[model samples]
Target: MTASNDIDALAAMLLVRELESALSAREDCGFQLLSSGQEAVAVGVAAALLAQDQLLCSGRSIAPALARGLDPGRVMAELIGRASGPCLGRGGRGHLSQPSAGFFGAHAVVAGNLSIAAGVALALQARLDRSIAVCLFGDGACGAGALHETMNIAALWQLPLLLVCDNNLYSVSTPRAAALAPQRLSDLAAPFGIKACTVDGMDVRSVRGAAVALTDHVRSGGGPAFLECVSRRFASHSTSARETRGQQELAADRELDPITRLEKALLLEGALSTQTALGLREQVRARVTAACAFAEASPLPVPDEAFADVG
Candidate 1:
């Protein structure tokens, strides 16, 4: 469940994890919704995506953007509000978009990108490109009206959109089970007759398999689909949010870290040797370092620059 028995998947997951870790250590790194524990969900879904497909995500954009093949250096720049970023750093964290790169961008609003994804899907359907739009949202957005309305239209029109809920169990400080009524979040899609399934978000292979199947269904004109990835959040909701979990609970959750899970399993199978694993880590660390250097050297936007992209 951790991988498709593929080292590439493992590598991608590590890259994001490390890149974020580097950012976390920086004093200037603004408040972030670090995808510390949800790397598997982003990497797994990205693995199944085609270059032409568009990916829209929530504010936790670092992992998704990196997973979708954006330049890590530029992503780092964007995260830190540098002029060298893909959106000229104006988009910042929650608004990093490089549509030409197939990353439609991330929305800071919980359910904000849901309808936007539907619109993108409709446009894709009109263009007859057969490419799809994948929207990665969190469990907190599950209660939004936009999701339901978008689902209804996506199902009715058979738009090539995939709704993936990166359900990390807790929405900020509140437990998902406490806020939502459905036994399974995927059940919300069932009423629309959309194909749906729930998988282990912490397992890269599981998420990849489910994403591939659902993306295929959308590609073949099977309309929209929904995938719920049940995962755990390692950190408090955000860098700015206070930790609400107890010490024992935090220790237990760390045991489920997706990266460690795959790394341990692969080591046991001899698919990955200690030397190779260490090498991969070093390689990714160098990449993150290089990215950091690039970001640090890049200049910030001039004050007037803010008026440039304005309507």
Candidate 2:
């Protein structure tokens, strides 16, 4: 039940580097740029999960997908619409999943994964398993009907689900304060009668602490809990969207970048050294490069293969 501090640090660094590589690739391909900011929320929340836990991500959850064990090259390939990528390049960057790593999948429709996560949790409950479901979505998703319904159902049934609201402040260009009436997203779950708590989304350790407690509750059959991770997205909406003007306006929010924060924590605690940090960065870069090469060298999905898995 202890937090995997080592894995958390590794995941944060790896996600950031891979994101940088993806952005560089997009830039070369004449795209505007993939998002640059938002590393803390995804990596922080993901670091809280057990290897056996399930994740339901949103379009912006590339970091979590990578940390959960998806190959960076395959992720990049998906972004570029290559046939060798996950979903055979059909799902694209946002709609991602790595079942082998317990990542259920992501949804394009806002709040679409909430209900799916509930279903997964319900199934796990029926099986009498201790595994919990982790549902991630943006602050914008909190306004959706799925959020309301899923919260009610999960709490009413006492399903073991952790609803992580990556409250990045903006749902596309509209800030949460302007679009949502209740700025505090955690309040929504209160009506559903579930335990809800908010955390400093920018700090992985804080997120890890909250996740540990919440997962423990779920393991003991304590229904569900909602965690609103209030973080910021450093990148634009995607690699092609240049209209994203929030990052500039949100510069004040970057006072605590998760990657830097974690590195400092590791260094101060003497858990790792500067040389080790550099080596880790290099290792991540090499792994990302290798993944890209793997995707490029792998054969593209065949033209007739589209219907092979659709029942």
Report backbone clashes per prediction: 0, 10
**Ten-residue stretch with the least lDDT total in model 2:** 27-36
Tens digits of per-residue lDDT for model 1, 1-311: 33344688788889988998899899988888888889999999998889999999999898899999999999999999999999998988899899999999899999999999999999999988889999999999999999999999999999999999999888888999899999999999999999999999998888999999999999999999999999888878888999998999889878888988889989998889999999999999999999999999999999999689578
TM-score of 2: 0.89
Instruction: Summarize candidate 2's per-residue lDDT along 35-152 as a digit string, tens digits.
Output: 3455665666666677778888877656667766676877777666677777787776667777767888787778888999999999878877688899888898988899999988
TM-score of every candidate relative to the true structure: 0.97, 0.89
Q: What is the lDDT of residue 259 in candidate 2?
A: 74
Tell me the lDDT of model 2 at 241.
58
| Global lDDT of each candidate | 0.92, 0.74
Given candidate 2, what's the lDDT at residue 73?
Answer: 77
